[model samples]
Target chain A: MANEVAADANEHGSGGGMPDPMHQFEIKRQVELDVFGIDASFTNSSLFMVIAAILISSFLIFSMRGRALVPGRMQSLAELSYEFIASMVRDNVGAAGQRYFPFIFTLFMFVLFCNMLGMVPYTFTVTSHIIVTFALASFIFLAVTVIAFARHGAGFLQYFVPKGVPALLLPLLVVIELISYLTRPISLSVRLFANMMAGHTMLKVFGSFVVGLGVLGGWAPLAFMVAFTGLEILVAFLQAYVFAILTCIYLHDALHMH
Target chain B: MPQLEIADFAPQLIWLAITFGSLYLVMARIALPRIGMVIEERRDRIASDLDQAEQLKQKTEEAIATYEQALAESRAKAHAIAQETREKISTELEAERMKLDRKLLDQTEAAEARIDAAKDDALSQIKDVAATTTEAIVTSLIGGKLTKRDVSAAVTKALSE
Candidate 1:
């Protein structure tokens, strides 16, 4: 998506020859490879995902090496993240969700790290891509559906039919409920991807303004960029929280069906 | 937009699967459980510490109770000993007093006997004196002296009257 915009900017001869704001989102192949003829080339996006994985693993694993009775700063951070997700599962999904803590925790850390890493200059925002978010969302949707079927069997379909509705309107309500239910993945994925992409794009646009405007006039946009960066950081954390919490909510719906 | 590039999706998904799957394994197998164990261990340690504290407190209370019991027992014994000693002294004093009273009574009776003997001796002397004086007077008046026996008998009759 950003590659197309960068090309357009290049063809148009960008105003003041400023770098394309969309160029940062371009997917450049770092190590081209063929995995069973599948073009599984290693790209900047893959690099960041690997970095996110490594950072998350190392942060959680190494920080907890001490296992102190009284936690230190890093250890406290690790514990706080753990408890944060743990409580999210407990509060949103109940005790039944305890078994799924690791998965939820992983999803949160992955998305959180990706979003945060993207905030750094010259880093690719993996979650900015719709496909990535869609993958995660669809996986959650599939897992939740599987869990619903496993737990409630055919009774899971009853979730579409609301109780206390007029019998005459039941068919219409069921169809609406089914549509909404089917759109869960789309909504979930787009919500995260849109937020990440939009925030980053806004930051890039303002950054270009800062560059295009000379030093005297650039301060205004520069200041806005600073404040907006803070907000983007907040949005980054919030989106990850939303992603994980929604997963919990969906799991709750799947498990409890109400 | 590179995001819409279907060509990039495969690699991204493949890497995502590799990285995310491996991360999940690390978390589930190594990282998460270690954290959980630490937390669990801390909880257990705290619970055991509380149990130990409670036990120590109970022991302290028991020790205090025992000390108090011993103190009360000794206090009662001390009271009993003092009471016994006081009663023994009182009885001893009473016996000593009774002995002194008997000795005083004996001394008074002996002194009275001595006084009576002294009075009797003086009275005998007075009779003899009276007999001697009467003989002298008769001799002087009638040119003759009465016998001692007679004088004694006359003195005795006068003393009796």
Candidate 2:
């Protein structure tokens, strides 16, 4: 479920001293820590994650400080982000989901900042790691499961069984729903992690080719790299959006069991 | 990639949890509430301002109406005063004309009476002179004394002729 295997790139390391395509994703320890055999050392990855968090908070807090009747550009961006997540939760989870706006909005901004920060020349993509994405997805999955059980009791099982099915097809349908339900964390985590990992790997791969081919022969891959980078930037935003909306959907399922 | 090394997982997960939770705290506690409050405040201010404007407009309209009503009432009062003055002056003028006419009439009657008196006096004087002259002429011619009654009768007869 964790796409932690490094891409095959040692063969292409002939461009001496040129960093590996997957090297940008590596976690290098910055501040070491060990708590009862747990390696909770702060790394470059940790630094970037904290930076993303700080950036999101500052962007929201400072930009909206003036609170103008007519919003300025920075304020508009801040308000747009607020309404975007608010409406996303409202639409997917209904009016009952207003209480969860903060969490959903936070998750969205955190993932969005992480992805966008990765697009910068040197920042690490925290969501690109299985450990991080899986942790987030598993938390959502567990919370939804608990909520579904608490809210609906044993009636939550009706979600997997569905309604008005042929008795012959009931078992088949239930099995399918249960498997699909079990795969939520794996699918959610893998989706964001793969999109980012693949997009970054591809960009580096093409970049390596561009350097390897020298000046005149590099235009093709360079153009592709440009196009791919644009696509990756779009993917970065889209992946965060997809992840947040899916969480809302799960929450809706938990609340409704329909 | 060090991500594959599995040893890095603990560090990244710990940081992710701490960073994400802190961000959530900031958003929930400070950022969102401030923004919502500002928006709500702006909406309330606009609503109150509109209400104030509406009230002012209605008050202005009422004031204008009262002013116009007062102006119209004053205009009507002025017309009544002018009309009353005009009527009073006309009645006074009419009375003065009547008085003057009566005075002129009295003076014309008095002048006529005095002329009649003077004409009567002159006529009597002229008759007396004529009588005296007749008597004197008769006596002078005839050289005889006449009785006063005869002379008078004779004069009267002659005047009559």
Candidate 3:
């Protein structure tokens, strides 16, 4: 459905260039009307992300409505997502952090749904873009910083101070702590974005070759396509898991700071 | 091929920020609280049910004990009543046999007195008859012989006495 709709768009009109798989990442100016002199670009990536958000919300809400003791498949899936994040947060962040279970579970489910949504053909993989991943990472970074300050007050600054360090090594330890703190958002974002983009790009390259080779000569490309598809699916789930776990670790740093 | 422009990345980041912020707010404010409430409510309900079940079990055991105790008391009372009634019947039978023995002894004494009186009357009559017979025989025999009357008279007097 996504491909046919995009193909129809291409057939009826010109969007100025041929559709590269990366073309979806390009920001298109959507509303002619500007707000506060800032323009909104509702690109294909943004559109698909919106779709993913709506899909995830509706899926969980509808699945949980009856709240049956004996769960159906969808309810079980929703519950599994909940319990998985709850356990992850508890293990990493400890008992004090259990209060944040709902937030962590939501984060996991949303990212997981969005990641899986991109695997469908012709849909834009928003996490493939640095901007989407960076935004998520920044949110976590800010939230942890806020929680650290809220919980510890002036003591939050102690995160940069090393425990049991020799006076001679204090300078070096502070620098290391500062650098690690600053790099959290960057590493968190890059890990997800790079993995998603690289895997999808590989799949596209092999897929096109399979098509270009046509029937008799397609065997090699077909095999590559199958293996790559499986790998991409694995990467999708791994990226979501990595995103969630990293958030938990960050939360742990905020709560414990040791 | 045209190089990608820097401006292309700007709008993407802006939209990403907006979406991310919106998602965080919605989760923190709305969805999380509702889910937490549901979970807490379920926990409370289960705890209360368990407490009620425990109380009911304890009460049931108490009732069973009370029932068993009452049953034991009833059995003891029945045994005592049976023992008392058996003793009463045995003593009543002993009293009845003693009364019957006394009446039998009195009837045997009255029968022995009547037998004594009848025996005395028969003995007197038999003596008188025996004397008359002997006298006639003796007199007839003795008449042939002189003075046979005197010997017969003396024999009759001795028999009478």
Candidate 4:
């Protein structure tokens, strides 16, 4: 907010110079609360995360509160969300993953909403942050790992050893598998974060070109921005879907040890 | 950027948990089941409606078949009745024709018999007249008292000749 105030003040001085595109991702302190030096403040990121959550809840609850048999537009959207996640879970994990439907659905909707909300001009994207994505990914990883251990006992370790590999190559393959397994959270977190950051940055760059090239020459960049924005929207939905499905696959690996 | 800052992790996680936890609760508790139920209910309703439609169509087809069968039955009955009536009328006509034929035949036989009797009577009368006439002629010419037997034999001979 302080930077925004300064930016607003500077717009008057510089006659509409373009601000840094990455600046939009900055977290502004909304309510400062430092508990034991944790600096656990409610920032803009928290605000948007809450907004996304509330929006998701209300969008679902209110839209389907009537639960019309022939669903209207918003209710149809609600149901679409439900089926999309349900099918994702079922496809990735099969019947055994049904119990995790709520979690997968929640994660999918949460990430989807966060990514889409970031598309707004000044909105903060929570999923764009490594902290948020990593937290989600790590939680999923831990849960899946625990589930694997609980379900398969010591046999879960066999997942790291391929069934058809020669005994001589088994140790090397095992190490590779272990490394890949350990990198799940990192890869999952980075995939979403990097995509969101890169897409937003590209949009910002194109957007700057549109603004910097005046009304006469800005039409090309403007059109490109329009097209790029559409692509980014698709990316947003895709990233969320990717996140959810990967979690399910990880969950399946844990449950079936395959 | 603030996103890379290590200090912000706690706040992000805390709020993520707080909000996402509620979202999950609402989804599992209220939203998902309702949506699932609505979808399931719609699918079942469609299936049942299709079943009902199929049943009704079959019933209609069966009714048509039954009606056609009855029509065919009634048509056959009418044909049989017409055939029976025609045969009865023809047999009655045949009997009447035979009765008329018998009556006409008897009338014709009576006429033929009468004609024959008349013809025979006429011929006998003619022969008697001839004999009498011949005997009278002979008496007139001869003018003598002749025996009756001789007159008779004379007349018979004349006639035989």
Separate DockQ for every predicted complex: 0.75, 0.54, 0.18, 0.58
A61-94 in candidate 2: lDDT tens per residue? 8898788988999998988888899889989999
Model 3 error, position B112 (Å): 5.0
Please identify which of the two predictions, 1 or 3, would achieve the higher lDDT against the true structure: 1
If scored against the real structure, what TM-score would every candidate get?
0.92, 0.79, 0.78, 0.86
- Relative to the unseen true structure, what is the C-alpha lDDT of residue A203 in candidate 3, on a scale of 0 to 100? 76
What is the Å distance of residue B40 in model 4 from its true position?
A: 0.6
> Under CAPRI classification, how is model 3 graded?
incorrect
Clashing pairs in model 4, backbone N/Cα/C closer than 3 A: none
lDDT of 4 by residue, A152-181 (tens): 999998899899878999989999999999
Judging by TM-score, tell me the better candidate of 2 and 3: 2
TM-score rank order:
1, 4, 2, 3
Model number with the top TM-score? 1
Q: Which one is best on DockQ? A: 1
Q: Lowest summed lDDT over 10 consecutive residues: which window, candidate 4 chain A?
A: A7-16
Runs in model 3 with CA error above 4 Å? A1-33, A67-76, A98-102, A220-224, B1-5, B108-161
**TM-score of chain A for each candidate?**
0.94, 0.92, 0.86, 0.93
Question: Best to worst by DockQ, what's the order?
Answer: 1, 4, 2, 3
Candidate closer to the true structure by TM-score (higher is better), 2 or 4: 4
The full ranking of all candidates by lDDT, starting with the best, is: 1, 4, 2, 3
Q: List the residue pairs that clash in candidate 1.
A: A1-B1, A1-B2, A1-B3, A2-B1, A2-B2
Which candidate number has the best lDDT?
Answer: 1
Give me the chain B TM-score of candidate 4.
0.70
Candidate 3 lDDT, tens digit per residue, B54-141?
9999999999999999999999999999999999998899898888888888787777777777777666565555555655676687
